[model samples]
Target chain A: MNAPPITTASAESPALPNRFDLTAAIKDGLKTALIMLGLSIPILAYKTDQSGGDLWLSPRWGLVAILCALVFGLRILLHAFMATKAAREATPSPHQATEFVHAEPNAFQKTSRFAIPFFLGVALAFPVIIYFIQGGLNESRYWVDLGILILTYVMLGWGLNIVVGLAGLLDLGYVAFYAVGAYSYALLSTTFGLSFWICLPLAGILAGFWGMILGFPVLRLRGDYLAIVTLAFGEIIRLVLINWTDLTNGGAGISSIPRATFFGLPFTSGEGGFAQTFGLEFNGMHRIIFLYYLILALALLTNFVTMRLRKLPVGRAWEALREDEIACRSLGINTTNVKLTAFAIGAMFGGFAGSFFAVRQGFVSPESFNFLESAIILAIVVLGGMGSQIGVAIAAIVLVGGPEILRNLTFLQAVFGSGFDPNEYRLLLFGAGMVAMMVWRPRGLISERSPTVILKERKAISGSLVKEGHG
Target chain B: MRWIQDPLLDVQHLTMRFGGLVAINDLSFKVGRGDITALIGPNGAGKTTVFNCITGFYKPTEGLIAMRKPDGSNLLLERLPGNSINWKAKVARTFQNIRLFSGMTLLENLLVAQHNPLMLSSGYTFLGILGLGGYRTAEKEAIEKAKFWLEKTRLIDRADDPAGDLPYGDQRRLEIARAMCTDPLLLCLDEPAAGLNPRESLELNNLLLSIRKDHGTSLLLIEHDMSVVMEISDHVVVLDYGTKIADGTPSEVKSDPRVIAAYLGVDDEEVEQVEAEIGV
Candidate 1:
């Protein structure tokens, strides 16, 4: 095999006898440059500019040419590097092809026993710690808000983790349930004058109902087909919200919905309000603190329920289904009920988070419940180990909080010209971050599974042992 | 002792066809209660198709698969769903390829076999999630049952290991252990000794013998290994081209002219001389 390849190479390229193929390198570079120019012309050559309330297209030919040149040069360099490396290791060992991509568990993975509790402790004290560090509630309000957002996403990630992670349903329209919950709360509270407490459970139930409705049609679907159907389901819900003028207010959004009161006491400055009843200085920080705690409690509830459920028979059925649907069926597991239960339970939690979002913002909008939210939540679940509760929390913090934290990096402006705002390149950095994370850890950050049921002693099972589902 | 009079499973003129391809054609056989029956066939002779029909994995196009329950009631297996055969009819089966829940612990795999009982005791997960006393008792009982089978399969020490991590022979035994944990009336094994060495085959023979003698579980095995077939089977049914050519005791099947011809790919006249020369 090795001899034939060498003979063929020598016969094809008699002119380049030394094997330093400069002409080939130039050909590859020119081809890449042309492809780059064709792709980048429409996207980079023209930019949308809004000046003094007027929108117009501005040409960026020089910038486009510079970017194309950079792409060409980079492609050439990469090809040359790869070619030289291949030449250096000409006789590849057979074992190299069969060897596993990852070795045994690393030091960090082994210490997950300590890492989980440490992360929990930090999460529990985050708002208080931020308050003390900022020296005042007013200064720490933004940090508290960001914390709430991250925690909300953590809760959502954990919620979707049941259906997609544990059951292996590949739900791309999970945000449809979130939207259902938001609309359920918004409509019930505004039309019927219901309290946030009354609307919370109602929203969850309605969202879960929608989840089953979507789940029923796609029960027979698997893998990419399931994903596509789910994605369509999400889009259908968003479109319905946008077009339904009578109920959802048609993208104008519902405002002044009502803030979440302290169980019946409103967070108002007037008499009989929470601030007055408690006899504290009527500051807005009280409501912020209450909302923060409310979401923290909700997130913890999601974690606790998932933890307890993992030990149950149904939970094992879900994991078994994820491992091998055919095997699960052969085991006499009622796969229909198992799948429906997973979707309903996962949707219920997403609904709870959605209602919380409405209460936190004091407004409801279709804009907040879009495909992007579903993508981010799904990303968090995958980046976190699929069924891991703590991994989801850490991933939410790093992926969501990381981008928000980048907004505070003023030093980046000095390094990359005065107009270089870090927030402007947030999505670019996000895509790059995702690529790097996948390259570094293909399985996930916390891929080890703590067996739901164990023998005399419980042990963490390696992710390599866990099947991520063929369906 | 009462079941000894009637067959545990009866298939009458069972036929399965996929589009225009007749996988099983006019097949009829019976599995005796508390007996190890071997179904031997050449490659693509539809031995697995017969197993599938009996186990309710495939609903035969034309057949009456009557399974005799403990109460002497007959279950129309072809009409029932695949899981109903496993759960209600108590007909459990292993696959040609090992299909143990690979990601789960060996104990967990066995425990999942007791899902129906545990789920019922737990009030369909309500009491289970609450960690109620009833659910706890049921779970403890399930773990005990799983441990029992794990011990029987000689995998008690590796109960915590993932099922996939076990060696091939151990995995085969674990599949049987998991099926036994389900409290099956009929255990159907497809190619259990396909890849086993001599020692492993001997161990598997002992395990199967113990299961039949100690537990009184009716076993229907589809096997290609002639030594395994000739050694352990009380009744042997030979199949060729999706039809039962011979059915008898081990010694009787070994000397049958059609069985010899089917296995050796010789004509009917040549089969007698071949069997006589081998002194079967």
Candidate 2:
């Protein structure tokens, strides 16, 4: 019925046994080896001591040669194998070539329903399980700290999900509100001598107010333009913090910020301390445990509020705005208010997380709020699937907690030699994972969404049915 | 056709210019209350422009658009912001191309149309978030209203389906249903029957006629389908080259020489006949 097929692969080019040419392999290896040497010169060739007192030149010529040899060997082997395989399968079978592109998922999808709840159970039991496994709170502090860090991102991801995921507004300066919250709490606590609890809500409100301020002019902008403006807003806030020395203390930041107390009772070793009030001996572990639960409760609150908001009128308005801004306007939804509300609510959560971050660390710095932090939070949202709350949590654990997990893998040194630090390669893996995820599941790890409003039983809508928005 | 003595919507010397190009030039017309007014012309003849201006999608370069409501209040539509027209002036519109909140469910699409009311009831989401009884009652009423429209549009079965997943005909119906949920005094439909098959067009005509008959909604539509326009429209306004050529009942406008000449692409002699028929 159609045009005749062109020459098949076997008829076009027959594979020969002499595919392994040593000379070509050596040429490719030499070129790659030279490029690696040129690239690694600055980073690997010279090293300065932490104190800037000593300098040394260390050459890894042997390792470079070994890596080059491995690359060359792998390339040649792959070429030969691929060539032979191609010749064998030259005559394409109709059945083999014509499977539907969007067929049902094979193995992984079948297990996802079980996997989600299993992971949730694990997350809920994480701290207690670790406490028992490590035999006491002392040994579990590191894991608890890591848990706190991951939950913070999960909260941030869920918060930003409301704006970027549901509302379809790409906000790159999310960290600015985070900074606002952190500073608000820091300044409130230090100057006015307020407690963390009082400063927390105040910080969130201040951050949300700032969110509306920034949201006003940029609400008219869509897609990449919105992203660029938000990114600039984030950088502007950072720059302001750096230049304004009196209020922010410039680069020095506000240090020695007061820690959060258990209600009015402090966690210190004094008479009115939490442990002292309870008639228990003051163990520093109490503070660590308290902070973990505090952040956990905050994160859960973020999740709960987000989930509830999804069913509200404003939440539906956000999703509608994301789908079609023109349609939204035609429906009499004030696009300005919808977009501003998204920014404010998302910023509110970020503010909450930031204040917690301040109380947790007992310090605030300009360094904490940066572009990289925003990117990482955005990465978590994107990798999680924009609108899925559970997806964001899992992505946080995998992306944020994954790198920390790598830090503990000391056995990696035996494989790549002692100089190899896994922490340095965390970003490399992050980039690779993001690229891989785009190719594999462009919608995200959890793409299917349960519609917030439904009739009868709720059905999970496929990601293909949803708009990813301008972002 | 019998009509109200006073025009519900009055457009005076409406002119829309986009830089050097004039889209609508000194256009003037009147749409009577509770009347189905069809705006028809050849493509690029500014049929949709009039609808856009009346619906506040575009502010005419020079015009006074006044809408006399049932309460005897007059609204200057052009003075209002685009989004506010739906709420303040009670004017809702459907796009030439279907623009349902495609990502949302059919019911959700209708609910979004009632956003202003629901938003107010929820105290701008503050009360809604707190799960107050007042917000719940408002939400329930909104859902009931959405269900009523869904039933009217014959899309009650597919109410839970994502609007984008609906068939083309249902999407058209859903767009109308969604607009109806907004409870507009005047519904501006931009080619609601554009892509529909014969049966769907018939359904659309019935739906629109029912809207006017049962709900007392005054419709100002931009239509390309002559059959639908002739069969249903109480009044027809014809435009050519951004200017109104004929304005009267369907038969009067249909037989007008200017509309025939514009559609047939006639020469100078026909143009004179058009000018004579228009008495300009």
Candidate 3:
């Protein structure tokens, strides 16, 4: 279930005068039904199929009728909802407004104090918890791998959050850095036989180098120009990977590159392996657990560094640049370098996550890093509220973990017809969720920002005041 | 006219052209150290253009805008790149449109202005992340400066509030305070009192006076409000059609017929007569 986003409105909305004219609501529904009819006639009412050189139309008027009815009913409900909301806002509740303002910051601190530790404990105990719940290693391995996947996304989200959320730079090619990191690690490990630990930092440095390379040419561009260029940058990286047969193996992908060792100790079942060293039975579960923990540690490191950076001068400069580049220059901040550092630092984290992906899969490929990955990561940051750190974490969990939960919605298939696939509805839900988020809370899930430094006491800034960044 | 005593900035023959359109054409002015200088002009008279050129926002086609540093060395503002005018020469400015980090707290807005010092102390964020740098001490000093400015601007109480949440008058004062955090030798303000009510602007006048008196920072402002221009300005420079028509003390410039004609407007025939009076 979605969390209630409007705490203040929830408390005061019932006090508003509630009125609905049945005739007006029915008229509104009738209009929507007419529109739905016009839309569904060609698409939903019939299926076009060609067989034996003949075109045929199979009518499905029942499906059309159900969809039209649903829309009409939903529209009526929406009209009433909008009416009540408008009425509530029309009433000037000065006392409630002041109380909400004073209470917000304290509420934030209290929730985070509880939430952060709870998340840490959940994360640290996740693999073990799943192992017990699923009854055995064989059954739980799927979930352990899913945990690693979610954490990878969480790390990527946090990394992109720095550029898009805090710095307000629209980068559509973040996956290029991830690809650079993965390829660097794969090449270094396979050619030179360097350890994962040795290649990790080098991979990050390589990705950061690429980040600056991409950053230099696009320094003057902003908003849409910046986005288009970055998008092209991502495509260029992908194309090179696909065509560069000598270096990248040309899209067939480099398999058997390497599996990560536990600090020079492999997780093999043989002698001197992790199982033999621990004097336990040889089970592949150890490696899954290790990978999960490894990514969890890495993701937490990203979060910790980002949190620390927010308090530093460089981070403040990024936020200031987001507000106004001219003002930043007036204040003596070298906007060029501030922007470059943001790109580089953000890319460095992406590089780390990319290399981790390669090591976990024991393979490297161009197909793994794509623009879709960058979009999902960017979407996570924006949905979390641009500059809110904890919000990013929660959003990553919902987006990445929500799909896993969706796989279990078999009951929905029973309720709807057998033709209805729960898996197919995920996309529909995603689209609906995004549209709803934009209309009701455009800023994000957790929009209010807590000031880093306070002279007296902390105060929560309303999301309406925050700029989501044009770029 | 008499020369400026202990001049802080001398801008000479500054010209800025956007392809064929000239925004500022061969304008010159001198801002005295520890004095409040006002640039008063009619709408579209290139007041902001001159300010932009001075602040290194726009590259003048031809100019010798020299900033006299505290060490008695002259640094050419025109040649210096964007931002070094503030970091190297200590010339800070505010926009006509308030450009505060509206989402950030008032304290953070001020802290960002002291980035030059704090960045070096933090080793450009590398050592600071590791907790191995002198950033802690530098940040304390920066915050102290911010607090001082906040108190001076009478915004200490709302230091934690977002800059955008403040009313128009407080936002203007916060912009100045944010500018002051850079420890500038000359602070350029563009229409700081444009949106403020009479009472709020009266407070702004007191704030600007206190800044000059207490910090001894040179103040250069572009203002349409004659009350603010005539009251606090040690010297006033009046511009018409991108040309300086009157450059003298406030009393002298206030009485100049050219200055009055530019503001009050004159017919096409009277324009030449007023121009002739200035001997251009």
| Pairs that collide, model 1 | none
lDDT per residue (tens digit) for residues A1-471 in model 1: 345566677567434333557688778888998898898887888999999999999999898789878987887788778777666576456867676333245565678779978888887898789989999888999999998989999999999999988888899899998888888888888889999999999999999998899889988998899999999999999999989989899898888888899999998999999999989879898898899889989999989988888888888888888887777767777788889999999999999998998888878888887899999999999999889887888899989999998999999988999999999998899999999989887777888777787777766677887888744
In the range A74-135, model 2's lDDT, one tens digit per residue, is 66676667656666676466767476222233343466679877876776788899999999
Question: lDDT by residue for model 3 over B99-168, one digit each (tens)?
Answer: 9999899999999999999999999788999998688898999999999999999899888888887878
Q: Model 3: residues >4 Å from true position, as ranges?
A: A1-21, A24-75, A94-103, A106-109, A417-420, B1-5, B267-280
Best-matching candidate per TM-score: 3
iRMSD in angstroms, per model: 2.7, 2.9, 1.9
What TM-score would each prediction reach against the true structure? 0.87, 0.87, 0.92
Off by over 4 Å in 2: A1-121, A417-419, B1-4, B272-280
Candidate 2 docking class: acceptable
True contacts kept of each: 0.63, 0.66, 0.90
> In candidate 2, how many Å is residue A136 off?
1.6
Candidate 3 chain A lDDT trough over 10 residues, lowest sum: A100-109
Q: In order, what lDDT does every prediction score?
A: 0.86, 0.86, 0.88
Per-residue accuracy of model 3 over A32-127 as CA lDDT, tens digit each: 999999999977899988999999999999999999999999999998898877877766787865652442554555698799899999999998
DockQ of each: 0.50, 0.45, 0.67
